[model samples]
Target: MNWYRFSDLAIDDDEISMLRRVHIYVCSSKDLEPESAGGTEIGKMLFHLYRQGVRSELGLIRMVTEGEPPPAAEAE
Candidate 1:
C-alpha cells in the first residue's frame, strides 16, 4: 500500500481498505490484548482515519482504540 503525509489530503479507497484490514486483523484475535503494540497501532491508524473522514463505525473503532497508545512516529 502507498503512504502519504497527513497534509497531503489525498487518501484513497485502497488506503482506507488497508486501514480497515489492519483493524480487523488485529482486533479479531482473541489472544491479542487491546493494549498490545499491534493493537495500539491499529487504534492509532483508526483514529487517524476517523480524523480524515473515513470510518465504517466510529463507536466500534473507539471501543477498541480509545485508550490504546498511538503509533510510533516512524509509522507515519
Candidate 2:
C-alpha cells in the first residue's frame, strides 16, 4: 500500500510558475490491514490524476532506485 499527496500548478496569476513544480509524496507500506490499504488508495488516486494530465507534466520527477548508481558514474 502507498499514500500519495499531489500538488500541481494552481490556476491563478500568482501561481503560474510557482505551481509548475508539482510535488507527490507517497508513503508505501507492505501491510494488508485496512489502514495500509487506505494508503494504497491514495497512491492510486494520484496515479489517476497523472493519467488524466492534471499537472503540467503529470508529476514527472527524477528517481533513484536501489542498486542503480547516479548517471555521472555510469560508464560511457
Candidate 3:
C-alpha cells in the first residue's frame, strides 16, 4: 500500500521546485492498483488536499528511486 514516510513528506526547496517544473511527468501518468482502482489514489489524495486549499500552489510530481525507469510494479 502507499504510505507516507517522514522523508516522503519533508521539504527541500531546490528539489521540490525542480519537481514542480516536471509535475506533468508524474501527476499526469496514472497506474491503477488493486487497493484503489479507477483513478490514481495519490492523485485523488492531492486533489482532495487542493480542494481544501493551501497558501501556495501545490503541484504533485514523482521521481525514480529504484526498480523500473517509470517506477512501477513494485512494493516499497
Candidate 4:
C-alpha cells in the first residue's frame, strides 16, 4: 500500500504488504499494547532492514515518521 516515499528509494510491494500487516496487528491487538509490542517490533524490523541495506522510500518515511535517522550511506 505504498506506506512511504523518500528520494529515489521506494519500498517494494512486498515490504508494503508487510507494513500493512504490522499496522493491522498493532491496531487489532489490544493485548499487545502499541508501545511495547507494536513499537518494538516495528523498530526492530526497521533496524534490521537498515542493517541489511534495504533502504527504501517507504523505510525512510517510516524512519522520519518515527523520529529516526535514515540509513547510513555506503563507504566510498
Task: Estimate the TM-score of every prediction.
Answer: 0.37, 0.29, 0.26, 0.31
Of the candidates numbered 2 and 3, which has the greater lDDT value?
3
User: What tens-digit string does per-residue lDDT give for candidate 3 at 1-76?
Assistant: 9787776566578754644433334444444441344435544554444334321342333222123365456686
Q: Each candidate's root-mean-square deviation in Å?
A: 12.4, 12.9, 12.4, 12.8
lDDT digits (tens) for residues 1-76 of candidate 4 = 6544473465567866665555445334323554576666755665466545755645544552465443458899
TM-score top scorer: 1
Candidate 1 C-alpha lDDT tens digits along 9-59: 665787667566657655764345657787777668676766666645655
| Number of backbone-clashing residue pairs for each candidate, in the order shown | 0, 1, 0, 1
lDDT for 36 in candidate 4 is: 72
Index of the highest-lDDT prediction: 1
Give all candidates' CA lDDT scores: 0.63, 0.39, 0.43, 0.54
lDDT tens string, model 2, 20-66?
23222233222233236655564455445645554443242222122
Runs off by more than 4 Å, candidate 1: 1-26, 29-31, 58-76
